[model samples]
Each structure stands twice: as structure tokens, then as C-alpha cells.
Target: MPKDVYVDQDECTSCGQCADNLPEVFAMDDDDLAYVVDGGNTAAGEDAIQEEIDQCPGECIHWKE
Candidate 1:
């Protein structure tokens, strides 16, 4: 599977839902924007990331290669 967590800064609300769901992947930056911390660096690619995506109120998460 490809990278499953993506945060569109323009659309992100910085609600912390993604980080709350999966801290191993999602992280909030100093600017309060969400980003994939482990993205392509970890084995956690799809399932957990999908859960975070589903829980994001802003629906800012996406999965793509």
C-alpha cells in the first residue's frame, strides 16, 4: 500500500483528531498544521492511517502513491 495520511494545509482545521487517533503517524506542527510524521518511514501505512482519515472532521486526509 502507498502512503495513507496526507494533510491539506488549506483545508485542515487543526482539530487534532488525526494526531489523537494515531500519533505514530499524524503530528501537529508549531503552526498547528497536521503532517504525517512517519509517512514513508514506518511500516504503518494504510490501516491505522485510514482510521485517522475517517476520524478527521475536516476530511483532510488522503491516500495516494
Candidate 2:
């Protein structure tokens, strides 16, 4: 199964990189913080998502356990 992804809102910096890079899986909320879209295509694969996580300025994105 694919690993699930999420954003730690408390740690989010509202950078918008994840949304900018992967709109299909991430988006900015009304608060301008990044959030994982519901029913997002996690099948976009781990490497792609991990790249965003690695590049995120806030480092708020993570894989769910």
C-alpha cells in the first residue's frame, strides 16, 4: 500500500511550495497553510511526495505511520 502523506499545520509556515508543486495532492487552506487534499492521488508515488517534503521550507509534510 502507498504511504499516506500529511502536513503538520502547527509547523507549517504557509510557504505554499507543496501546493505549488503538487496541487493534486496538496493545497492551501483559507489560513494559507498547506494541507493534504482529501482522496488525493497518493499513488503519485513516494519519491515525488518525498521531494516536496524535502524541499518544503517549513518541513511540515510527513508520511503517516
Global lDDT scores for all candidate models: 0.75, 0.88
Tens-digit lDDT string for candidate 2 (1-65) = 88899999999998888888889899999999988898764647789999998999887899998
- Candidate 2 positional error at 1, Å: 0.7
* Per-prediction TM-score to the true structure, in the order listed: 0.78, 0.91
lDDT of 1 by residue, 1-65 (tens): 36444688778998988877677777899999988785432647577777777878888888755
**Clashing residue pairs found in predicted model 1:** none
Candidate 2 residue spans exceeding 4 A from truth:
41-43
Model 1: residues with Cα > 4 Å off, grouped in runs: 1-4, 39-45
Give the 10-residue window scoring lowest on summed lDDT in candidate 1. 38-47
